[model samples]
Target: MPRRAEPPARRATVRDVAARAGVSPGTVSKALNGTGQISRATRDRILAAAQEIDFRPNALARSVFERRSYTVGLITTDSFERFSVPVMLGAEDALGAGKISVFMCDSRDDPIREKHYVDVLLGRRVDGFIVTGRIFNEREPLDVSPGVPVVYALTPSSDPGDCSIVVDDAAAGRVAGEHLIRLGRRRIGHITGSAWFDPARRRAAGLAEALGAAGLEVAGDPLYGDWTEAWGRQATHILLRSCPEVDAIYCGSDILARGVGDSLRELGRRVPEDVALIGTDNWEFIAGGARPPLTSVDLGLSTVGRLAARRLLEAIGGNSRAGKEYVPCHLVVRGSTDDLPPASTGSAS
Candidate 1:
């Protein structure tokens, strides 16, 4: 064969793909990333051209061109908290797998820290924000940085349509309430975590529905407090004083259940016998270390994290059916609620 000249080097770009496909550069990107409101035939043509031209994405150049960091900002309270850690880890792993870098900020349960972190992340021009669970009321400082998609985990701001990944809190509470009732306990008390949090509110609502369905009222008003051992211990006393006849108590969290167990035993009560108990946030390894493991609702923390990250990646890749996503929860029964007769111990219990 006769000697031939080498092909000239040309930087691969959306423009080149557009030219080859007889379309616009905007159309080319939309097709490649599967985004933008475009016709299916046109998208197909652009994709075919991109493949033919061997277009490789230079993420660094793309970031510079778009004036973005291509990084996702994850803001959470209490990073060291056992439940939060698993969720954060799942999000990080999923994001990393999608070639996305994570920039994390811990609020440590302080609104000031939370606002500061939001400001910093906004300044960094992150592509998206994953707001983890924090107790922010309407009066709290709001972060309204435009042009970046925001995804929330565990909680969302008061505004509607904010994309979020959360477990159905009310459903979880209903599960707890139903379980106690099914166990033949007529008088059920409640030990709730922070009332300021929205999830706590939903849980209370769920508990009410469950009890209402069984034609039984809650033993008394729920003992409201934080999700701490101290509060759990304190609330147990209040619950007992308010409803001495209560035969079961649905705690807001496993930590609270642990405290309740301590209090019950101190008062000469036997778990699942004198007073059966149920809790949420099956933080089993840490909170359910008691002799008889605490029965709880598995809120699917890791699942929430993974789903949030996956949804974020999908958005970045141009899939835009974005809104709130909820992961369902199930009950994990242990010794705490085992007093139910063998015949009544259904699959859920």
Candidate 2:
């Protein structure tokens, strides 16, 4: 039989670029990343050599030398949901734009799996990590991966030493509460997320505060449940029965808001007429095109993702990590709420 052709040799590397550019491997890296006080001329020559030789930097080896994997770990509980995809995409887009890679892990809300991912990601020397789900408040001082910069998407796990990005859920809730109050709805009910999540708890507090400021209280005990449509529907039915005079309902999320609308219809009540409804997660893409639109609070999930990614990148680049950062939320009004005639400014219900 004819001899098999010899396999092609491995591709050129940063070492090759360094040799062709008459510089060191470190210099080549500086040129590629565009930093480290290297002269423009030297950087250009190094880049030219790399392009000529088609040099591919060894990511794993480079990570070893620099104590950086240039890889980010994204750990989430609900990793496969529509709401989470935007956040993951945002983070991936930001990091990948900088030529970084990502490793994703799902905790499935299991504490054991969550802790295991922390160790696994750290073992891989990932430059940073992004966590989403519930804000972990470090109920106790648990040792975590040392030197790994971590940021939370919506829920911030409590690590005072770590940086985090969160939406002003309290502000979102307050806005929703005030809007209903302004619409002359005095009897308002609330369907909120479980107290275990900080965002949900804070939002509920804000709702209460807003109502209190208006010289009123929640029409009834706030209905608490998970952040799911099923819970929202169940909570809505209970609220209606418990607070028969309620004229408005504030749902914790757009998903819940949709359920609330459905339940209202089933109860022979017209939305906005018998019970105006509001929810968080503007969910414009999901709610916008509905026959009657849904009003919601825009928590800026993409913004949170982008901000967290940027902060992680900055930390990896040796920037000083600071305390937590809170991103603001905006309210998007739609047809789910009443279409009252325009009112003069500064007028309260």
- Give each model's whole-structure lDDT: 0.78, 0.78
lDDT of 1 at 304: 85
lDDT of 2 at 231: 86
The digit string of per-residue lDDT tens for model 2 on 20-120 reads: 99999888888887779999899989988988988877777767877776888888777556546667888988998888898988888778998898788
Q: Count the backbone clashes (under 3 Å) in each candidate.
A: 0, 3
Runs off by more than 4 Å, candidate 1? 1-69, 79-83, 109-124, 136-145, 318-323, 342-349
Q: Which digits, one per residue and each the tens of the lDDT, describe model 1 over residues 1-349?
A: 9889998988788889989999888777777666689898898888788889898878887788766677988887755656557678889888877577888888887878888887888787777877775442322224747556767777654555566777888899899999988888988888888787777788888999999998988888977888887888888788787777778889888888888888887776778787898888888684468758888899888888888888776666666444566799999989889966422211110
**CA lDDT of 14 in candidate 1?**
80
